[model samples]
Target: MIISTKLTAERLEEIKNHPTSYDENSPKLTKAQIARLRPAHEAYWNVTPVKKTISIKIDADILAALQSGGKGYQTKINSILRKAITTGDY
Candidate 1:
């Protein structure tokens, strides 16, 4: 599904306003409930160790393009690489 920029902004504002509507008596999970949920949350945090790293060369123009995109270029590259790996397209 395509997300329109205007709808995205509106949805974000709706989420931002949601907290203000909460009442003091809003239903909350008890300590026992949270204890039962902890295992699933912890499982998500259990990550496998990185086995290796490799240095690769890229064309100057491509490197410049990433750099020109500004801050978080390395993070953007990592995201792109992750997507490529997931899709087996690299």
Candidate 2:
């Protein structure tokens, strides 16, 4: 990610004129914050790889049910399956 921080003299003057627009001493993250974040970060990295797709068939009623919601039916199906796997409900 590329971050650009260019502060012109005019911009600095505007900030000084409106200091209240910004939050001061926003809560700092500590070691406890790092500990709390580790599990979710690790879980994200532990995801299994998706295999390549192949031709398949399903009941016409089920296909219609998925397609009735609107566009991107295939993506929606994948999202449903992913949520089920994540929640151990599949």
Candidate 3:
């Protein structure tokens, strides 16, 4: 659904220099129009993407320890695993 429009170098420069000026004073959308906007088409757009979900089981003690690291423990674990993989530490 992408559209391509050819722009001259001058037009490009104009855009770069004045991006926000294009519609600076435009009327804001009414609540109904805002509500009609589509939700994200890509599921990945709403996901962290650092790792995929799986159902692997770990020791209860180890799981608790990782979770103790707090709110983003799962993401932290994935980052740790990524580093370990790159370094062949596991």
Candidate 4:
């Protein structure tokens, strides 16, 4: 998640004049830890799979169960369907 703030002109000027200082005593990463780091795109695929909009009838109870989790219920259903498709284990 990303957060942004709108700073006033005075606040921006203050920041430019006196930048925040970092803690010198803070813990540093080890060589092994640094080596394990991967680019964000590598760790999380940047590709967005094409999506299709269609309607399929599902059991009322199952639909209720999926929606009980709240928002993103459609996404949850998509994930379940994708898993079933890949593993052939509906």
Q: Best lDDT goes to which candidate? A: 4
| Top-TM-score candidate index | 4
The C-alpha stretches of model 2 lying farther than 4 A from their native spots are 1-51
State the lDDT of candidate 1 residue by residue for 1-90, as single tens digits.
Answer: 965567577888876787544457865666566545545577776787474567889899988999999998877888898767645467
How displaced is residue 89 in candidate 1, in Å?
Answer: 1.3
Every candidate's lDDT: 0.72, 0.74, 0.72, 0.78
lDDT of 2 by residue, 1-90 (tens): 853467978767776797443345665565556445546467678877776787788899999999999999998978887877655465
Better of 2 and 4 by TM-score: 4
The clash count of every prediction, one per candidate, is 0, 0, 0, 0
TM-score of 3: 0.42
Reference-based TM-score of each model: 0.41, 0.44, 0.42, 0.46
Candidate 3, residues 1-90, lDDT tens digits: the string is: 843466978768767797453355775666567656556785655765554678888899988999998899888878898777645467
Model 4 TM-score is 0.46
Evaluation by TM-score, superior candidate among 1 and 4:
4
lDDT of 4 at 76: 98
Residue 84's lDDT in candidate 1:
79
lDDT of 4 by residue, 30-72 (tens): 6566657567777475568899889899999999999999999
Q: Which ten residues in a row are the worst by lDDT in model 2?
A: 19-28
Span of ten consecutive residues with least summed lDDT in model 1? 31-40
